[model samples]
Target chain A: SQTIHQWPATLVQPVGSPLSLECTVEGTSNPNLYWYRQAAGRGLQLLFYSVGIGQISSEVPQNLSASRPQDRQFILSSKKLLLSDSGFYLCAWNPSGRKTQYFGPGTRLLVL
Target chain B: AQSVSQHNHHVILSEAASLELGCNYSYGGTVNLFWYVQYPGQHLQLLLKYFSGDPLVKGIKGFEAEFIKSKFSFNLRKPSVQWSDTAEYFCAVSYGSTLGRLYFGRGTQLTVWP
Candidate 1:
């Protein structure tokens, strides 16, 4: 069974703060990892995706970046957060050859 | 570029009512379709997927979706709805060699009243 884990389940940060959200997968190796931001009525927006370690493809230009430091570990970071950066962050993964993706619990960030 | 379109943004239905959520994709090439459900306060879960073979795919919780290649539509259907079925449903399309790059439609929020 494969599972994805994301943390700080919920966070509240002031504007102009640094942000880092981590995602890790279990029971899978060399999986395709993705970062998405979900907003109410806006659906899930693709942020970044990685095929392997040190390889990240960003979908949209934003105040954030992603890194695949380890095979199953992905991190989303930002040097300075903006008020518009607050949303539900989701991490997902699928096997290398599959198109079906599984999502994590998600991190709700509130930038005040 | 591939894109998905969900016709309904919000739907209100009573218990025992029928459900038909429309989902359409713009890519005519080889594509994989999926429907995901997100219950209140829960993560997204796969409701069903269409890779090939049967055009009609059955999923858990008595939900099913039909893939119409000519129409480019994969609409979800349920015979009878329950109050517990209140959740947001998302339609996604994936094609080419983009790996996990799935184009998602703005989800349809289904609210069932008992």
Candidate 2:
């Protein structure tokens, strides 16, 4: 069975600080990876998606950015964090040519 | 703009009560619909999906949704509710033209009293 993992289940960062959230998938290769932010009432917003290594697509313009260093490893980063950047971040993966997505546990980042 | 809409923001019901959540979309062309559940401090889990064929599709945990193309609505239904059913539900849609993007609604918070 395939499983997705995310690091720093919870995070507390100061404003203007750098941030890094990692996501890795097991039992799958060349999968489509996505980054989403779940706000209080806005539901989940797609931030970035990657179909392959070094190929990332941004769905919305924001303070965050995403990268696919390895085939199954995805990273979400920010040079300087903002108060509005605080939210629940989720990483999801789906096989190529498939629409169903499997999500990770998520990282709750609180920017103070 | 093309988007997914969940009419109810929050719903509170008693145990054994029926469950009905409305989800509507305003996109043209072939689209895929999905319902996902998120418990407290948990990630979203797929509840059900509709692609083609039967209009009514059953999902895990006794949850079912019917897709009505004419109405552009995909409503979720459950005959009985349990306290464990207290969670947030999200509706998402993906158009055929958009290959790797999914449009999600604002989510409905379901609170079931025991």
Candidate 3:
């Protein structure tokens, strides 16, 4: 069975602060990873997706960026966060060529 | 670009009430459709998916959805919804060739009252 883990389940940060959210998947290799943000009462917005290591696609350009350091590790980072960046960030992974995506617990970030 | 639409933003029903959540998509090419349920404080879970074969797909928790190709609609249905079914439901669509890029709808929040 595969499991996805995300750190700092909840965080509170001041404006212009750096942001780093980690996501790791165990029991799968070469999986497709995705980063999404869900604002309150709004649909999810895809931020980034990676097909392989060092390959990242931005769905919507904003204050966030994504990186795939290892096959199973994906990180979402921002040099300086904005108030609009506050939302529930989610990390998802699925096997290559598979349509079913498995999501992690998610990180709730509040930029004050 | 593919786009999805979920008709109901919020719905309230009593336990044992039948559920029918409308989902529509706009894409000329072949596409895959999925329904995901997010329980309160939990990760999103796959409720059902439609790739091919049966137009009607049965998912976990007594939920099912029917795909109408001509109508470009995939509507979720449940015979009798329980109070535990209170959750947010999302409809997603993606091109068949690009499995990783999914376009999600605004989502329908279902509130099944006890």
Candidate 4:
């Protein structure tokens, strides 16, 4: 069975501070990874997706960026955080060419 | 662009009551539909999916959904609800045979009262 892990389940960051959220998947290789953010009581907004290592596609332009450093490791980072950057972030993985996705426990970020 | 719509924002039902949540999509070509459930403080889990063959598909926890192509709708159904079933349900769609990406609905928050 495959499992996705995310670090710092909840984070509190000061405005203008740098931020990084890491996601790693075990038991799968060359999986498609995605980053999504959900505002309070709202729908998910796709931030970025990667089909392979060092290949990332941005769905929307924002303060965040994503990187696939390894086949099973994905990282979401920001040089400087904004108040608007606060939200529930989710990381998901799907095997290549598969339609179904498995999600990791989300990271709740709060900027104060 | 493809989009998904979930009609109900929130629904409160009593335990043992029938459950039905409406989901609609706006895509002309072939598409794949899925229903995902997110328990409080948990990640999203696939409940059911409709690709081909039978229009009605059964999923975990006695949940089911029917895909009506002509109506452009895929509605989720559960014969009875339980307190443990309270969670947020999302409906998603992908264009054609390619998984490419998923367009998700706003989601429906279902609360089953004991």
Best by DockQ: 1
User: Which stretches in model 2 have alpha-carbon errors above 4 Å?
Assistant: none
Candidate 4 lDDT over residue span B21-107, tens digit each: 999999778888899999998889999988889999999999999999999999999999999999999998887754458888999
lDDT of 4 by residue, A38-82 (tens): 898777878899999999999999899999989999999999999
DockQ of 2: 0.76
Error of 2 at A44 (Å): 0.5
Model 3 clash pairs are none
lDDT (Cα, 0-100) at A16 in candidate 1? 94
Flag regions of model 3 displaced more than 4 Å.
Answer: none
Q: Give lDDT for model 1.
A: 0.94
Docking class of 2: medium
lDDT by residue (tens digit), candidate 1, A1-112: 8889999999999999999999999999999999999876687899999999999999999999999999999999999999999999999999998889999999999999
lDDT of each: 0.94, 0.94, 0.93, 0.92
Interface RMSD of each: 0.9, 1.1, 1.1, 1.3
Error of 2 at B102 (Å): 1.2
Q: Which has the better TM-score: candidate 1, or candidate 2?
A: 2
Query: Sort by lDDT, best first: what order?
Result: 1, 2, 3, 4
Native contacts kept (model 3)? 0.59
Calculate DockQ per candidate and list them.
0.81, 0.76, 0.73, 0.66
lDDT, model 4, position A20: 95
Q: Determine the TM-score of chain B of model 2.
A: 0.97
Superposition error at B110 for model 2 (Å): 0.6
Which regions of candidate 1 deviate over 4 angstroms? none
Q: Pairing residues by index, what is the TM-score of model 1?
A: 0.97
